[model samples]
Target: MNVTQFIVDTYGAGTPLVSTAKRYRPSSTATKKGYILIFAHGTGFHKEHWEPIIERLYAHGGPVVEAWAIDAQTHGAAATLNRDAIDEPGFTYSSYHFAEACANLCKTHLNGTRHPIVLVGHSAGAASAALVPSFYGQSRTPPFSALILVEPAIWPGSMIGMADSLAYKLACVAIPRRRTTWRSRDAVRKDLGRRAPWGTWDKRILDLYVEHGFEEDKEGVSLRCNPVHETQPFINQINAVYPVAELDKLRKKVPVHLVYGERNDLFTREKQESLLRGRRFASVIRIPGAGHLVVQEAPDAVGDVLLSILGGLENQRYVEREYVL
Candidate 1:
């Protein structure tokens, strides 16, 4: 394995934002008694967006830990990842599959010998974290030490009515609707979310997207996450190859924390309840007056809650498991 650092460009944060990672050494010995935090970036956002959040976790977390954040496939520097094979003959990539692959990657490449990780994903990433582990393999991981799902956009799984589904279906239409490829970044922005209400992001964040979402197309300028890369993924997700029922299938032992912004239009109160379905085992939080971008909206509140969870986890003592080493 090549142990080095490199950057991959993505549709959202390609040139402007950077997703950088570094490992924290636990100790010389002791089986590396530390936790691992694997982050899943949000839609139209990359890992760099979580830099402030991750810094808060590092600063406040107890028992010491290591963390890494991945740019969601096709969204960040990992944009080129599987680019050539978006709609490959043998490849079937769903959101669930994407999450599983990320977990596998974390297990394989992350510099730690630790079990019982602290898995956290934001927006679409949160949905994946809340749902993927249970389906990975029988008894492989105990549904992560704690799953933190933050303000997932397309949430409340069952509240998915026909109208919303239809809207998503229309978005999928972008797959075959290659009428005129955008030649400039301006064209792409004009088309984003139908240009209605623009995006409810911090103005600076929205500007950053404009800066990164477009490139110098040979014809003029074209968007990187074009029809094929995006529309196909949209198609794949709606028709998910493997649907996760709930967290139970993953493992009941692992706890889950579902966090959302109170004022978030994406994961509204009703939408979150629908997704969670009032599950008893998991924890739920509604950040007061926050929006879809909770971390950026209320960094202090988010950090406080996360640190509280980690603090509780740090105090728990695990019993010996039967194993042959």
Candidate 2:
């Protein structure tokens, strides 16, 4: 499947929250009939991780639909944002920057669109996308037409609260950092290709994984998904609380689609319900045998599910709108 890489250049000051992205458009073109989907990829990987799933959708789905995948700040091809590296003793990794990066993309690239826009995310990326409604609300950014979050890491605290924020900060610091080794890294790469406990995915989805996923020097090669910048704080309850409420408010403006992989260890059903239960225009989808990387684990099924959701949003005339103020 042929594709094109587009740079949704966005930067953040706190960490090396650099991001790059890719998009997959349908091969066949009609007068046009679908929504614009902005995809957020899982952590410890790059945007390319969702390439196969996006490609699969492009092949079988409507011309009315389009899909895209973005790297979290400091991961994938977004190496430039590494300027102010994380060097402090207590500082740690956080997905806070990912949310900021997503907001900037919607403001700079996705704003003023005529078609309905759906934000789709997986794992950490899903966590990032899941925050889109709230994040935009805090910043006065335009709201999306709908949202689709897959097994996001949004429920670290059971509820979105201070304890959750602190725990995430501490965990990013506490997790044992794996030292690099040429032999071990090669093994990790190999393992990533095989079927996960819940599902299967192509290893090639992460050739870009080679960059941050591997650390090289005199030591040769070692695993490297959680770079210092990746570990830096990107989400903060106190700092980003407005966005969370914005997400709630945006529910009044557009439909919100939430999806989860049944095998996902990250987001439980209770958490999924918590993320959208109060919202009027929200729907949750559960994929039977998928995991954190649902798109890769069940590319075909993921594609089909996305197509169906897109069709529903289109049928409802869920068009994207721009803010006048």
**Best model per lDDT:** 2
**Candidate 2 lDDT, 1-325, residue by residue in tens:** 4456666544454443456666566666633656777777766566776666677666665534566677765565564444245334554444556767776776766666666677877766666675655553455544566777666555433455433334345545553353335655556566555534312554454444554456565666654444544443334433223335645656666676666777635344554555555555456788888755676667677878877887776677755455321
lDDT of each: 0.53, 0.59
What candidate 2 gets wrong by more than 4 Å, as runs, is: 8-11, 15-17, 27-31, 79-94, 133-141, 156-175, 179-188, 191-218, 222-224, 227-244, 276-281, 318-325
Q: Worst 10-residue stretch by lDDT in candidate 1?
A: 9-18
- The global Cα lDDT (0 to 1) of model 2 is 0.59
How does candidate 2 fare on TM-score? Answer: 0.74
Colliding pairs, model 1: 8-77, 10-76, 134-250, 156-275, 183-221
What's model 1's overall lDDT?
A: 0.53
Model 2 alpha-carbon miss at residue 20, Å:
1.5
TM-score of each: 0.67, 0.74
